[model samples]
Target: MVGYARGVSRVLVSAVLVAAALLLAGCGSDAPPVSRPSSLPIPDGFTRVGGLSNGLVMAIPSSWRSVDLSKTDFEKELEASGLTGATLEQAKTSLRSLQKSKALYAMDPASQQESPDGFVTNLNGFCQPSVGASADALIEIAKQQLTSVNAKVSEAASVPLGQGTAVRIRYTLPLGKALINGTQYYVPSDKGRTCVVTLSTDLTGKNALFDQIGGTIRPV
Candidate 1:
């Protein structure tokens, strides 16, 4: 039930990032993919954002704002990214005080999405896993947490994403009279970083924006 989970995605993600940031991904330096075979055109209405400098890239509608780490922590992140070669546990604890943040690259109110209405989407990046965590392990962890409350989890599977692998976790959360469906694409890059792309709507299935954005991801 971990990935099947809804409201808790933010918390789990933030905690995970802060819990293991320094060890897994050391202030990721910007680098561009040398190939784009898995790449697809950016959706017609969406604009591509981010560049090699940020260490990742994606496409989304133009309305969203790129969230920034709290200004106070700016220098802190810079400092953490510089050090290397620590024991696994030390790197994990080092992230305890860190702030885990995500960016909302697209949000459009004008668009029409009902059912479990959804309007915003986010992209997240996590670096190498010293534990050598795989896509299956990621899916398994999410399922355990989400199943505790009897969340409906189905179509749990892993697919190759570029040179890496991605776990697709689909689930529904009961909200009184309505049920919210969510689709999460968690990809661990060939380089060892992880990218999580998610979409949740009160509606029944996938949204165009969601599908479109998924097309542009090269993953590795």
Candidate 2:
């Protein structure tokens, strides 16, 4: 089960970076200029994140805090997120991974308060070069990758996102005795890359909130 978790993590992290077969797409600092304060409709109880030269705009729950590893004080960020000790180390590792991939990351402040070693509900996004693969094809590749790792894939389809459409996938994977629920979106961008957004959590009932957040993703 630990292996399965590692596999799933590899698949998701790869999606944040290289994404097997598909070329990597950069975001964050390299993103195109977006309107000040964002022009997209902010969901109720959610705050819009990403801007300035970043290539995407997204909304996360108001209770969640977006992470900017480059500028954020790691130790302080973890404390504010209610993490400490080994959990802080784990989160620090995750944040470094996201930072290295140039991805945008966010998490619920109390996500790790209860289960110290459990998966934290979080959202992250990055981009991969389309390389001619359509959204449907990209999603299939993602599906195959997860299934290869024995992850249970429960959903895959193209869904509306912002002004365009994206391929969305929902899956569950075992981690020790727990199950991790995850949702991913492959959004084609005008910037010649496919933005891959992911929402992952241990909580099973956050899909509605995940959908609400994913709906706000738009290539800037």
Per-model TM values vs. the true structure: 0.56, 0.77
Task: Report every candidate's CA lDDT.
Answer: 0.43, 0.60
Task: Give stretches of model 2 more than 4 Å off.
Answer: 1-38, 52-54, 70-79, 113-118
Report the lDDT tens digits of candidate 1 across residue range 1-220: 0121233344334433332232122101112222343363566667775443333456766664333232343334433433234432443353333324232222233322322332222333322222344445556677775565455777567654443345667766554444545566664444544555555444444555565665455533
lDDT per residue for candidate 2 within 1-220, as digits (tens), equals 0000113345465543321111100112222222223457787788887753345678888888776544446446556665556656656655666564456767775665543445567777765444555445555667788876666889988775554566779987665555667788766665565566788776668899888888788765
Which 10-residue window of candidate 1 scores lowest in summed lDDT?
A: 22-31
How good is model 1 by TM-score? 0.56
Name the lDDT value of residue 37 in candidate 1.
33
TM-score of 2: 0.77
Model 1 residue 214 lDDT score: 57
